[model samples]
Target: MRQLRRLVLMAVCSTLVVASPTRSLAREGVTQQVHEARQEGSVWTAFAFNRHLSPFSLNVDVEGSVATLTGTVENEVKRELAEQVALGIDGIETVDNRIRVDPGVRPRLVSVAAVDERLDDATVEARVKSKLLWNTRTEGLDIGVESREGLVTLSGESASAQARELAGKLAASTEGVERVDNAIRVTGEPGTVARAQSEVAQAGNLLGDAWITGRVKTRFLSSDNLGALDISVRTDEGVVHLAGTVATAAEKELAVETARNVRGVLDVQAASLKVAG
Candidate 1:
């Protein structure tokens, strides 16, 4: 009986040893599948958020670090754009772009539930943040901006109540923003705003004139108070020239002030920015 018990114990140990490796292999396979699924999802989300690529029906497949794109676009430029966007995703080392460029292909109608409209939210957040950064009064304040749909929420610490109010105004002035929820706290800390401003100024000095011009244009485009397409922005050295037709004297004045506050702008020449009749 003792010998029989010993044999049974040995058999049990052998079974466990064999099952352990099989279980490990199964777990590894599942992990790999999950990783691939995540990669596919990331690629899909990137395509969905891009305005240029969103309208077209695109498909993404991922294996390991390689992403395969299959879709039909109107032109070759869009096909290349799809590939580049896929390459931008993290962990994607290679993109096999199998997209066909058929000039006759039309964009499919996407259902609202199928795609979350976070692109507009993202644009609103960026515009609000840029406005705050370009505004002299609120540029130095620690302001956190968040947007959901058209509603914007501001949170952070401010050195003064005026700064907090200014931050909210800047956010509200951004185009596409429907409401502003100002949650900024006033600390009344001396030199806090000044110190932050100094740091921002130092960083701004390193930016190129072209970069400054582009930023100014982007700000104008997102501003509710300005007509971006009507305005011409040109930066020379550190000076900005504005030649455009605005609705009122107040708008022209606002335009000048807006350009002047942008970092790296030494001066704004807006004599030619005439008010419309």
Candidate 2:
């Protein structure tokens, strides 16, 4: 009778353990802990004291592994910098930066600091160069930086269009930078001629469609929000097809929206992009 009772008790305990859903609870607890820790760290307060980010009015919202930045910054460079800073923090998976640009603030800021003389062109140039060298994004590229007065220019060959854009951003984010002129050219792949021939033959008489496709690609390449590195675009008549993997659902949505908004795009067909793991 005792053996029978012991067997029943063991079965009951096993059933209870199987039904507990402990894994889900553990995941939720970890996420909550990380969220609380980030809040305690005072991320926004740190932003205000950062040299590159200090000029902006910043607000930070931490949700799960994503950090969304909202507020106004003096320029596009500051806006990008705000996102970069948020992304640098631990446990952040994505940065949704929506910082408004107020270009008018630049002249007023320059005038306010006029009492302490401006950073010399050489000093500004050196600073920009050092930042570019240190930045992992543009460091590997053999780009050149030059500054005159307050305007900075970047010229050289980059491996990809993203590299060119990153180089420009690095220069613009420097303390004394007024403006950046990015003239960096993207080097073509070894099979460029064959690829161009294949494309021309495949789309023989659809010259207008080809032009529209080129325009869409250029727009994607130019945007700070969208990275066209892995995205491939094609056009047929007025219909555009987009295929590629993106970092998140947000990036996929932005790419499709951008393609659809183009002047000559009548329809956009985008396959479900695989989100990064």
Candidate 3:
């Protein structure tokens, strides 16, 4: 019985999952027909997104090769990480971010309030503390005020946007504040919005500049002994390798010429082309 259980467990564990549709866009095919078939427009993305994801409350949506993600996450870093994984797919064009942030998400900014003690010493500390404490918005601000001569300096991390923005105003308005140096860092999390934009920009470069225009179409094309299925183009440096299908022997020759003439191309490998009657 023990031996049988062990064998069954091994059998179940050894099963390798293959052909998951989620990342299939990474598969290689150079022909126009192949690209058209493999290019998942919208439906495949929408159906596949929720199939696997983190258990967090953030919501992600997909439509027509564009993915839109929403909902709130506990931490800012998790929000950015999730977006990175989704954009790794080849076919994705855009990502719309509508995700809300948690309370902790507002702390990306830091504020340092400093004062020159040469103005007023004794009441300056009390006065700064009173001002900070009185402001309802700065409750989460970790404050430190120091006085030399007569100036009061304040420093702390603001809790939210309003807090960081108002730190200078709040400090300068205080009674004993003579010169306020507000060093609050306003850093919004590099969440989906920032990352998605960067990825789209990168993809634009890839689509625009690769040496091989990929199974390109030509005005007057020809070939020789080229198989229509051998559309794979391998490039040795700047030289293009043509593989796959062709309609006639003329097409094989035409393809090699077409590849040779493409801008920045060095040469062509038309060996894989097969022409038929």
Q: Best candidate, lDDT-wise?
A: 1
Query: What are the TM-scores, per candidate, against the unseen true structure?
Result: 0.36, 0.28, 0.24
**Model 1 backbone overlap count:** 0
lDDT values of the candidates?
Answer: 0.68, 0.60, 0.44
lDDT of 2 by residue, 1-277 (tens): 4345446545644554577667335434433633433331335534633556755556666667777788877778878887777776667768887778887654223221321122244345545654554344454466776777789989888777776776787678776788899998999432111112221122222223534555566567667877435787777767899887888888888888998997658789987456677
lDDT of 3 by residue, 19-132 (tens): 434322322211221222222211222222221223344444444566677766666665665566557646656767566657564322211111111113323443454344
| Candidate 1 residue-wise lDDT, 223-244, digit = tens | 7787344888777757899997
Residue 189 in candidate 2 has what lDDT? Answer: 30
Rank by TM-score (best first) = 1, 2, 3
Worst 10 residues of 1 by lDDT: 198-207
lDDT of 3 at 39: 29
Best by the TM-score measure: 1
Among residues 3 or more apart in sequence or in different chains, the pairs in candidate 2 whose N, CA or C atoms overlap within 3 Å are none
Clash totals for all candidate models: 0, 0, 46
Worst 10 residues of 3 by lDDT: 110-119
Angstrom error of the Cα, residue 48, model 2: value is 2.5
